[model samples]
Every structure is written in structure tokens, then in C-alpha cells.
Target: MPEARAPVHVDGEVVASKRIGGYRHLTLTAPGVPERFRAGNFVAVSVAGHVTRRTLWVHRVRASSAFGPTLDVVVEARGSGTAWLTAQPVGAKVAITGPLGRAFALPKEAVSCLLVGEGYAAAPLFPLAERLRERGCAVSLVVSAPDEARLLSALEARRSARSVTVLTADGSVGQRGTVGDHVDDLVRRSEADVVYAAGPSHVLRAAAGAAERVGAWSQVAVETSMPCGTGLCHGCPLPVVGEDGVDRVVRACTEGPVVRGDRVRWDDL
Candidate 1:
């Protein structure tokens, strides 16, 4: 892990915002957030009239864009908080606190990697793929959604992964199926040593199990209701079996968001 940096609270200006497929993508001029960001780190954005801040995974970070340093996040406007974020104008200001939570651990060896992503939460994996490729790791990506518009860009995914597999539930685009139906086969084909996944709970659960069956290490980025991005709220509890053989609950905002797939109490969640 890169040297950790303290989270900073800043009033950031929305540099760009657009609709990408079925998601809302935004770029914010967050001065210190991008400088300290790691692949799995996320930002907590203050909602206009809500006391609760929305936690969004930092999709991509730009050290310098036309608007200066910026970071991107993809949001699904399924709730009031997210809806407000997507509605922000270019010049609108939003309060952001980041680069928070534990990051996905990278491997020391140049081993083959398999990345599984579903929906907008797949946002973080794009950067992870770049980092893995930089280390000369062979990366295979599996992107899935219910339909074409819900899937992340396969064109962009191809640039990072050695291979890209697209799956859709309704067959509106790629393969007609869900991750559970095809992941085991993909893992066997890639012979991946490590599997990294991000997305909905069901997707993560399925990916984790497939990786385990293939004897591959698995790390999953989980999405939960994080009322506050900081650990102070103790609102986002994740049940896990600690290394000490103890079953405990940890704050997703602090201890995780990224955790060993096997250790999670998936049945409980």
C-alpha cells in the first residue's frame, strides 16, 4: 500500500458531469483526494439537504486535467442522495472527504489476475486493472449487467485487460447470463492466481465462491449503506471471521469496503 494520507474535507467544484450508459459520472476538483487515492479508496460527498453523506468509489483519478487535478465517481441515481449528486451542475460545489477506507491489496508477483465487476460499482476496477498491467500482470476482466447500457465500457476495459468478457442477463449485449453462470469457467480459463471483484452483494458473493472453487485468492469490494464515510458513525457493520478465529463486526468505512472474500460472513449479510 502507498503511504497512507489523512482524509481531507474540501469544498470541491464539479468540473464535469455526464450520463454514461445507465450511470451518472462526475469529475470533481478535489485537491488532496486524488493525490492520496489508491484503487479501492472512495469519497464521501455531502448531500445538499441530507445530514448523511453518500459514499462513492473513486472510479478514476486524473492528476491533472484541463480543469486541474480531479477524480471521477460513478453514481446510480436510485436514491434521493444519489439523485442530488447526479443533478449537480458543472459549477456547483460539493463537500467531499476522502481518500477513505482500506484499499485492495496488490500482489508482489506478476501473476495472472481476474477482475469481476458488476454495475457502477465496477468503477474502481478500471484503475486496479491499470495498476496490475503496469506491474506486467496478465489481467482478464469480466464485466456484467442486466443489459447493454448497464455494463461498463468494454472498449475501455479492453485497453487494460488482456481479455474482456461481457455478460448481460437479458442478452441485449454480450453473453446472456449472470456472473454466477459464467465466472467459474472464466477463472478456469484464465488460471487466475488472484480474483478481485466489486459490485452488488450478490455479485461479490458469487465471484468470491467461484474464485475459492478455483483455488484463487479473492478480494471483494462491498457496497453497503454508509451513512457517514468516516468510521465515527459505526453505521456500516460488516461481519467477518477475524484472523484470530473470532467472528466480529468491523466498520466497512474503516476496516473495509475492501476485504478478503473468504472471511466475509456472506450468509449473514
Candidate 2:
């Protein structure tokens, strides 16, 4: 967990909700709280009891000096949990548990960092890019979308990036292909020392393949459905390589939702 942590009782009142291409970005205002929320860390939200509070990562953390923490969560609206969140009005007070989980381990020897994401997986990466850039790492973002509007919006937001690339299955974005196509090209041409991926399982798998092929250090953030944010629930467990070269299940809540790419058997997931 993050060390500079203090929980102030707060509610996320929906400030703005809009659909951009294939995904939805919702902004919430949680007053009087220090906005130390980072990219890899997530917030647990409570809706009706029928649906358990799901942990959603911070896509962007913006807080006005006048107000408190303003959080933006992006969801694809694929399930009941996200659907309920999307249906909420602008002033709804949603119970939120926050700023949990470990951070991305950036390499000191890295030349350039490459981030690859797709769909709703783009959330945590927005803050991550800024953090990496602040650390003096050359940061590049490659997000995939099905339409041009979403692709362009993401690209425009990171206009200050050393390089911004977009890929789409449809020919509507920068490249008419999956992010893997561009990732392959970037790794080869840019000679990036570290690669990070967050998105669909298949997308991560493809990135892992590319990273392994090039001998670059790769890490992936795995999105798991969890019953409890704490590890006791054992709901979000993934098979990880043990010290004995065997497989052992580890809880995503505690051990990690982020793990070394090579340690994960991408094909099994």
C-alpha cells in the first residue's frame, strides 16, 4: 500500500459523465481529501449491496486547491457494477475506499518507457505517464480504440509526450492495427528498455510476447474481479511461478494485481 495514506470520510459526487468513443469517463468530487491517489493504485466503490464494491484504478486525479480530490474513473460499461456507476447522476454520493495497492516499479536504467493499453484499461496509465515523465524517463503512450474520436482524444491529451502513438482495429486512428503492431515497431525502433501493459488479457499477452522476444523488462497490470479489496477473500487469485519453479496461486489484492510479465503464463490467463 502507499505510505502517505489517510482516509477522510468522503463521497464521490458525480461531476461529469460522458462517453468518448467506446468507453465512458466519469469525474467525481470527494471533498477535503488529500489527492495522493496514483496510477497503479485503485479505489473501491460501494453501490447497492447486490453488487460488491469493485476496485477501479485512478485514470486521472485532479483536485482544485479550493475543493478536495476530484477523481476520474473510466469504465467500458460492460457489467452491472459499471452500469450502475454510469447511471448515477451528477450529485450522487457514492461510498469509496481508496488509494490502495502497490505502484509500478520503474527501472533506473530505462532509456524510454512504453505503455500499451486498450479499452477501459487506459485508466491507470494516464497518471502513470505523468509520473514516469516526472521521473525523467522518456514516456510514450499507445492506446487502442475502435473509433477515431476516442483515439484522437487520448492522443491530444498527451500532446506534450515525447511521442504519442495510437492504434485501432478499424482504420480510424493513427495506425489501422492492434497496439501490438505499434508496440512491435516501437520496441524495435525506439529500443525502449522497459515496457508496461494494462488492458485486455489478450493485449497483455501480446505485449509480453513482444517484450520477451526483444529481451526488454516487461510488467503488466492484471485486472481481476475481487470480492474484497483485502486478501482474505481469495477471490482474485492468479497462478504465479514459485521459488521451486512450480505454480502457486497468489491473491491479486495483496500479492499483486501487477506482476512480472514473464512470471505470468499469459496463455493460461
Q: Give the clashing residue pairs of candidate 2, or none.
A: none
RMSD of 2: 2.6
State the lDDT of candidate 1 residue by residue for 24-130, as single tens digits.
88999987889889999899999988989999988889988898889989998998999999999999999999999989899999999999999888989999999
TM-score for each predicted model, relative to the true structure: 0.98, 0.88
TM-score for predicted model 1 compared with the true structure: 0.98
Question: What are the runs in model 2 whose C-alpha is more than 4 Å off?
Answer: 1-10, 31-34, 149-152
Residues 1-269 of candidate 2: C-alpha lDDT, one tens digit per residue: 23314444467677788887766777877654326565676777786755567777678777663345688887667688778877888777887766655557766653688888776766777777787887888887777876675552465447535777778889875788887666788777657778888887777877777888899888788887866665667888777786578988887766666777778866556
Clashes of 2: 0
Best by TM-score: 1
Clashing pairs in 1: none
Q: What alpha-carbon RMSD in Å does predicted model 1 have with respect to the real structure?
A: 1.1
